[model samples]
Target: MTIAVVWLEDDGLWCVSDTRISRRGQGGGVQIVTDAGAKIYPLNVECRLLTVERELYYGRRYGMVFAGMTAVATQTFATLSGMCQALQGASRQDIPSLRDVATLLSKLVELYVRDFRASTTLADPGVIEILLFGMCPVSRSYEIWRVSDQIVEGSLHVAIDQQPARTGDVVAIGSQVSRFQEILAELKQKTENTFRLPKIAVGQMADASRGDVGGAVSIGICNQFGFQTYWSLGLTPHGQGARLMFGVDLDDIGWVGPVVISGGGMA
Candidate 1:
């Protein structure tokens, strides 16, 4: 299980998620496999995605996180990270926009799900929820997007939704959903717009969370400068030789471990 939160702020996007990956037992219990899995990914100029829309509009500088089948999400994200790295040296004027990047991701997910379902006996590819937040160069506004896929009624379901937040919005998705409402309400009451509340709240929850969620958090931000990922809350480790995220090295950017969250909204 995972505890992922994306708090879209007026200036940028603050995000966090637990890094523990687990397997469920038939008896309705959870087992931890590892606590060092990378979740939040920071993308920058090291990657440039080329598109016909490049000349039309520069896309979003965004950060992404996912929950669900690790293999599916990891594999897909690996592809994306590579695209980012390859285009890292490309001219910014020709990069794609949030809409184009999102569309490409949706198509990739659908293709992966279909291939998996056909090649394996598994009914589906399992649930996958990917959260992308950042600034759209065109609108010059912050945005949050979700690309998700799963099997329902023996059919595949893929959805891409645009959910840009304003002050007082706290978006939470993962193993514990109902458990977050009260916390969100209390935080909102304390502060109308601030990242501190959400960050502290998520830390407390993760510390006290059941087997459904565990491990240190990975945090990051996406704004005018692009994605900046942290191995932990406000901490970015350096000099880690060629650390890989989902099987791709982010241009030797110092990275290992999970991410953090400090979600809040502002006008």
Candidate 2:
């Protein structure tokens, strides 16, 4: 089971992980270390892909990411690449908001699920969920939307924190949503006396987990009510294994700072 989390903040955004992934039917000690040696699927468009078959593309005014079980990673990536190609040449300033991105991903997942269900050998394809965070310049507001997954003949579940959503915020997407929330709750409940996970550290820890294919998480933190800092974590499964990729998108006035973090696991 792969798990990921992102955090958006005021000063800057950060992403991290534990670098552990487990193979199917593998027992104890048969673990895959993402840090040791693994192949990573990098986005030529400055985006991140997840093991669960979702994609996150970052733009100047818009940031978008999604997660959930679909077909194999290669097929999902091909579909996403097609979507990106369809999006190319459009003005960055006129990019879709996070909500719009999430909606599109949800729709795409539905289409894929339908196609898979029509196949004879595929059996059951898993579910897909998308969490979108958007910022509107004209309204000076942020919006977060959680799009539930609808697999043709399968089930996919998603859960989030109880707190009200915010624009330029983070989300956890996977079968292990409960675990993600537990981590978030533990972090929030910590007192000032104990060791506190910095926003970046928390973001990273959230990003690192097991079975995270096509999975992703994000965080958004504000700086004294100014611009926002965003961190996003993604998983991409490859032949016999998977890798975790991360990135940060900063919403500063003058300069735009973005970074990509990559690591993989063995078969």
Candidate 3:
């Protein structure tokens, strides 16, 4: 089984999940979605989960932190701790060094894969893939983390080269990425005014092969005053969901005060 989650906080965004990939009855966990439909019903996968109920830690932007655990507990904690350190050390800006964050995440994934191989776990386990997104200093970018369980074998995980377009980003996971994109495109084109994102949009982003759990996506605009008009799109094993929110960084708007936009357009 696998689990994933994305959270939006005042400071930034958070994404979390587990590495285990299991099928029905494999873990004795109930499927979150209904199985009624003439269309194909996506297979429900398992994941370690953390959310409002299983709170772990908290931050400024993110008031509550949750996750679903797997066998890779040590690896998960280490990776998260390392990410926090990197973020703390990173220079504060519009997009907080996304490449740097992605680099750190990749390193932690590799480290965990190596540790698992060295350990006497399940001999040879399959690899795991996770999709992560969060608010950065500039714009948001997605990171793909793949971990191979096969000992001394080829990579079980691979990062996608191109980032998906973020016209109206949503927080979601599942087998509905393509379908979700189609919906977003249609929404934007159909709107009479500028394609401004609603506060948040959530739904399932699935594909033909595998479904993602605890996945989330978000997008919108940040005006010159540092006010964020944002939306999130999320999808879990159960179904599609969305949330809308607006925020201003206390440090930017309160402490530093608003800045003037050079161009006439909103920042």
Candidate 4:
């Protein structure tokens, strides 16, 4: 499980999530499988059409963050991304805005559950939840909508029941929420208005996950351009001196490391 926190401050919508994906080890304990996978997707769509001797372009975006089963999140987003492509050559009425998100996800989640169960005998995946943030095309204001899916049979169910956060509110979703309380409590004692201090609150919550959640915390903010990550870059040497570049989401102000320009590659 990983943490995703969303809060509203002024007119800006802020969201943060850890990138960890974990599975049970051979010893039946939690083992981190990957720490670099992204849970927050900054989707920007620029739909273009070719006409008689001319080209037209339309652009928009919706930023989203997810928590819970990685498989579930991936399946849901693959469909959403496809819709972004269809925005081309369409009227404004066809563009799905922040309000259409919940309905769209409801259809995708139900389809995933029906097809997944039809194929596998594996245990049901817990709730796959997402917080979609962007500008309401009609209202011309920032908004965040919460969507969740859960599969329940005769007996088994696992998930986080997150209340829909209102404007000027904050909510944290994850399996580790209870576990992080003591840590946040201590941190809150030191910092006044932790919710207003998203970087501190989000960082402490991720660290409190121990192995269950640890990764570059992906934080995003809503703007006129839609949802964009508060992003930075990281570089580290490979086997030799050549360094690889990685996009990292910044929880706080990003710090730059050494920079080198190489003929063959980045250093």
- How many pairs collide in each candidate, listed in order? 15, 35, 54, 0
How do the residues 1-267 of candidate 2 rate in per-residue lDDT, one tens digit apiece? 344343444333222222333343456433433332111122222233332433444333233334444243335545754674445323334444444454555566556655655664444344444443444333445554555544333553222212124423445555565766666567657655322243333444534533443223333332223223223334344322222223221222224346533222111
Which of candidates 2 and 3 reaches a greater TM-score? 2
RMSD values for the candidates in order, in angstroms, are 7.5, 11.3, 14.1, 6.7
lDDT of each: 0.65, 0.39, 0.33, 0.61
> For model 4, which pairs clash?
none
The whole-model C-alpha lDDT of candidate 4 against the native structure comes to 0.61
TM-score of 2: 0.48
Residue 52 lDDT, candidate 3, scale 0-100: 36
162-224: candidate 1 lDDT, tens digit per residue: 875676676777777566566766777887675556666666666564786765566676767
Could you give candidate 4's per-residue lDDT for residues 136-198 as a string of tens digits?
676677767777655556533322233444564666667666645555567768867655555
Q: What TM-score, over all chains together, does every model reach?
A: 0.73, 0.48, 0.37, 0.72
Model 4 weakest 10-residue run by lDDT = 237-246
Better candidate by TM-score, 2 or 4? 4
Candidate whose lDDT is highest: 1
